[model samples]
Target: MERFVNWSGSLAFDAERLRQPTSEQEVIDIVHEALDRGGSVRPVGSGHSSTPLAETGDTLISFGRMAGLVGADKSNGRATLLPGTGLAEAGSALAEHGLAMENLGDVDYQSLAGAMGTGTHGTGRELGNLSSTLVGGTLVTGTGAVVRFGEQADSAQGQTLLRAAQLALGALGVLTSLTLRVQPAFDLHRQNWMTHIDWVLGHFEELSQTCRHVDFYWYPRSDRAQVRVLTLPGDEPAISPPGYLKKDERGPSYEVIPNFRDLKFDEMEYMLPLEHGLEAFRRVRERVKDRHRDKVGWRVLVRTVAPDDAMLSNIRQPTMTIALLQNASLDHEPYFRDMEALFLDWGGRPHWGKKHYRTAPDLRRMYPDWDAFLTLREKCDPEGVFLNDYLTEIFGLQGAP
Candidate 1:
């Protein structure tokens, strides 16, 4: 058996075989063989997801060999990228063509397909998650058929399929290529500072609304927080209190948007209604201070994401996300589960790729188009060739091959 482990060293599993395919035909062939043998095929991309979405005891397909920019259209500001291409690599490639991703998460090591599939996002009141940038893509369905959505779609049904494919959690099929809406290469000015949590909570609304991007990390041990904001050059600088400025710099959008994460940690993030975000954070803070402060050595992250139309998107409406992170070497279950209860009371939805304790029934109630996505998944992969034990349970599927 071949062993696989995630970036954070949290989830690990063994597979019967691991196959790396360099072409679309090879992916189709792999699926066909899995179907013939009545086995399962799970796709792995950087293994950045802390969840068991990629766990499997059967065949594992890796797209690392089939990476890089496939094509670019400067006139349309669009680019087609191989699914395995890392966000950092894609950014540099797109820059060469005078293009860039509109927004990106603080971590850029995830593959394009992995980020899209998991609804990864950055902080901004107006910017949707990375999946929202997907305009089209091609996937090898369970039946060994090539399906195209987005720009290639010519009808209403095709467009609907495209929306479902936008964030299918790798349950629909294996993505071979993705077409994204890019923009002319641009630059941004980033500023970071440390402040009291009370001040951040009081002024967060003003900061988020006036800045292009804003996020913060609140330490449990100390009530203090570190706030970071990004703005396009020449934009009015965000209002700040005296002596809070720690670092100020300007660089290309790609370089400035992401922070370098050197420490590994386990994380559980939930998206809640913007209206209830502050109160939820207050309650979480109280609980952490009252109970879990001794065990929590990492900070809590708060960010916002704009609403999007993807069927399974976490942000159906404007959302505020609160993430609980702990050192990878420490046990995270007790603290995460305790915080999760608070999030659920506030109508929270889990980030698909992160650690969560929700089942199909719990998730179905959270997403408005849950049934619609399931129907599409069935149409695309009726045989369930892509579902492993973890996906099978969450999707509420009956037997796995």
Candidate 2:
């Protein structure tokens, strides 16, 4: 019984039965049997989600054994993959055929289904999340029936299936296979640096215009911050960091925090008009320094994306996301409160897969089509078999009987 947790350095759930069903029929049988006994069933992938969406007492299914590149449509520039395939592996396999995903997240270990379930995304003002690349997929519902949907001429059905697949979140059912649209291979010319916070804020618009991919991360408790800017070939190029430095990991520095939830931190993030990104980040930095007396670390990362239409994506519009990472040994609640207040003032929306304390009421204010999303969830998962404390608390989902 091997058990694992998410990559955020938070949350773990030990299941009574952890089964790796190798075939579709086996998965169907497992779900049906769980229902027959009046129990719940949940499927887990790489456990990369920060939230405990996969927690279940009855049965836990892992898709690792059911992974591989099942088929490819080279002429149409598409590929059919098993749900358990790793994003990195999929990217590499597609390269062999002179094809590639439109974009990818920072880490590549996530399975196709798990990443799509939580709307794992990359950077690009016009590009949506990875799930947007999905042209079609096969979802095995709780009742053990496989339903395939995507690319219907009927606008309503196409839009419905598109939203359903964008952030399945394991509530809908087990995803068995995925078919994704691919693009011709491309390369990135990456730049890196440590710079003043003020300079970033003032020049964000110009920066976004200059770069193909732009993103930044801030380290709380430090005056200095790292910055990254990437561009495609034939773009106006300037000085970039030493090639070696640009390859560095740009997230939080490792620390031995026993309880990640209790760690004190503050963050302000927003999906800014791509042109306003540099200045938006700069404003956030200025605010943090003035408000917190404790030492803080600072950094900024930037990346690029092609294009897609996933509803849950931050890059649905041309967006520049600024993530502020704070470090401290105090309680996290108060800092989050202050941070959220500021984010609201600045019109920021929370990232779906990251840690944030916004309630449904607050979320309603942030999202315009929140009710529509709720309606979609109800239609696919009427029973709410996948509802958990996190989903209910954040999205206000009433657990299905």
On lDDT, the candidate that comes out on top is 1
Candidate 2 stretches with Cα past 4 Å from truth are 1-4, 152-159, 219-222, 234-236, 240-279, 293-316, 326-333
Cα lDDT tens digits, model 2, 159-257, are 666666667677777888888888776666655566654444455446656675555545555554455665664563464432234342221111100
* Model 2 poorest ten-residue lDDT run: 251-260
- Candidate 1 has its poorest 10 consecutive residues by lDDT at 235-244
Query: On a 0 to 100 scale, what is the lDDT of residue 301 in model 1?
Result: 97
* lDDT for each candidate structure: 0.91, 0.64
lDDT accuracy of residue 170 in candidate 2: 79
lDDT, residue 200, candidate 2: 48
Model 1: what TM-score?
Answer: 0.98
Local distance difference test, candidate 1:
0.91
